[model samples]
Target: MAILVTGGAGYIGSHIVRAFRLAGLDPVVVDDLSSGHREFVPDDVPLIELNIVRTKKLTEALRDHSIEAVVHLAGFKYAGVSVQRPLHTYQQNVQGTVSLLRAMAEHDIDKIVFSSSAAVYGTPDVDLVTERTATHPESPYGESKLVGEWVIAAQGRATGLRHTSLRYFNVVGSATDELYDSSPHNLFPLVIRALTEGHRPKIFGDDYPTPDGTCVRDYVHVADLADAHVVATQKLLAGQELEPVYNLGSGDGVSVRQIMTAVARATGIDFEPVVAPRRPGDPARIVASGQLAARDLSWTMRHTLDEMVESAWNARHQS
Candidate 1:
């Protein structure tokens, strides 16, 4: 039985697809290509170019591919921008998720791994967030994701659907040069683009209470995150008991200043990052404990900060 990866042509989704393939699993892709690149998907994999919002077509594809599971990663995922485009965010994330769940039920595909976000926690009050952190999403994007989790839980309770949602902080680095992150809003891409254009990268704030006086946030390597997804899929298929949600995080986080230094070291760009006022609603720090995922999904930080910067820089330059 094959796994259906919605938005499998996108950055993180593409990485998960490659991980599945490397693990000798068949992964069928269905993407609308809204922000996904067709080239990211391997030529051998079946690519069904359809939107998950199209429930009928989505269900048809699941049945046609004989799919037994799904990895749902298709959604509009920009928290700040979601403030301006709330309707779009809700439609793509909430409505689209509902449609996907309905399709799964219709096709009797009960296993799934959802790509959720740390945004669901908003500005967490504690130093380290856990799976039990109170969800008080500050933006439409985050609210949509939390709502998506609820929808999945509701379906699981009613239909015996086995599901898990992986909530992650900043996802960085690349497994392959050809599959680098292309999100316009991601910090790595933004920094890399600025440096490549001979512009100074900007740091939003440096007066936070952290030791470095900058915001400290978890930044996990994309490959590590993909591996967790693969493991989660395997566990579900084997009927292993699992948590409804897991945070794939860096228990210790890196500060923005540290990231700037890493960028300079990796790209050989020697310029101080310009400091700006913190964006509204920006948290001072948000790190998560990944002990649960580590025990269950073999999660670990395999890349150093330097490695993450180097890999991202190399891919940015290569692309």
Candidate 2:
């Protein structure tokens, strides 16, 4: 039986596709190609070009592929843009999830690893966020992810579906030069774009309570995050019980200023970042503890900050 990967043509999704392949699993892709690149998916893999909300098409693809499990990553991913386009966000994230679940139920495809976001915690109150932390999402994107988890959990209870939701922190770096993040709203890509184009990278807020006067966040390498998904899917397929949720985090916080410094060192560029006013609802600091994932899924932060920046820089240039 093949594994289905939603949004397998996108940045993070593409990495998960590679990870699954490295583990000797067959993966089929379903993506709208709205924000994902067609070439990111390997030519050997079957690609069904369609949105997840197209229930009829998705159901047909599931049956045709003999899909036994799914790694769900397709959705509206821009948290900042989600605020301005709440309706569009819900249509893509919430409705899209509902449709995928419907298709899975029809085909008896019972295993799924949800690609969730730290946004669900919305500037969490604690220093180290855990699965028990209360959710208070501040953006439509975050709310949609949290809702997706709820829907998946409810389906699991009703249908005996084996599933787990992985709440990701800042996902950066690249596993290969062939695939790199192209999101205009993400930090790593934005900074890389600016430096390559001979522009100063901008730091939105520099007056936060962080030690360096910038927003502190938990950043994890994209490749590491993808490996966790593979492990989760394997356990679920093996009839092993897993937690309903896990935080794929670094357990340590890295300030934006430190990122800028790391970029300068990596790229051999020396320019002060342009500090702008803080965005509304911006949290001063939000890091997470990946202890649960580490214990269950072998989650680990295998890359240093410098390595993350350097790898991202090299991939952007080489691709």
Candidate 3:
């Protein structure tokens, strides 16, 4: 009954892998050192250094290690990058997911905890969009993720493999340490990086309908987000009929301007951010209501915005 965590060496994947280990579960990891760190995974867990895109190698590793369930996280995720390289995004996210499913079905692994994204809901009309919201993804990255979900759903229906896709927005704060907090794409780290280098944090779209006229997003702490994954996976193991999709957010929407203010409050930095025009394909307000995860997974917010921001700042400085 070993859990096979794909991309376990990456930031969020490493946190989830560490969470599983901390909860008395030994997780086996399969990661190519593409965008992940080999040092992030604990020495105790078995590491099969192989690219999942290489189907034969991934299948060989799965059979060799007797992996029971998989937490699929290995994929390219930069939205702007995906825009430039749509084909690569499709191959990495969509094709990679199909390969994982084929290997799982072949090995008779019936359980999976998928890492879905909130990008599926691109520029929603409502303030707080729920899991039932219509998915009109505007970018190649979002399209790829939505397609990943489709692949899993289609496979799960044909085969009886149970799965739970947790759609997350923003994951901040420290899970293990500050060593893993230097991601270049996410907002929190982006701001911290700019401030650390004595550069102004750039804010896009400061004239929208919101109070600050900037895009808003939900920032869930990594630990609490990890906790949701644990609960979701446990439910699947218990023979529960997974909802197929659920939003894992705080239901509290924080604007970009508000995030800058929070950054200043959390880190005692007074550097102003440069107001830039709205980014291409940027969503104005993309906040998840997160009612389904709360009711079904029995999860709640364990950390505050201030706590999350401060922990992230502390992690940034400590590194």
Q: Report lDDT per candidate.
A: 0.93, 0.94, 0.84
Give lDDT tens digits, candidate 3, residues 168-285: 8888888655336567788988999899899999998799877778887888888888778777877887787768999998888888888899899988889788998887777777
Clashes of each: 0, 0, 0
Q: Mind giving the per-residue lDDT tens digits that candidate 2 earns over 195-247?
A: 88999999998888889899999999999999999999999999999999999
Candidate 1: count the clashes. 0
Compose the digit string of candidate 1's lDDT tens values, residues 1-319: 6999998999999999999999999999999999999999999999999889999988887777888789999999888899999999999999999999989889788999999999999999899999998999999999999999999999999989999999989999998899899999989999999998989999998999999999899999999999999999999999998999999998998999999999999988798999999988888899999999999999999999999999999887787
Ranking, lDDT, top scorer first? 2, 1, 3
Candidate 1 yields a Cα-based lDDT of 0.93
Model 2's alpha-carbon lDDT is 0.94
Cα RMSD for candidates in order: 0.8, 0.9, 1.4
The residue ranges of model 1 lying beyond 4 angstroms of the native Cα positions read none
lDDT of 3 at 249: 80
Candidate 2, which segments miss by more than 4 Å at Cα? Answer: none
Return the clash pairs for model 3, or none.
Answer: none
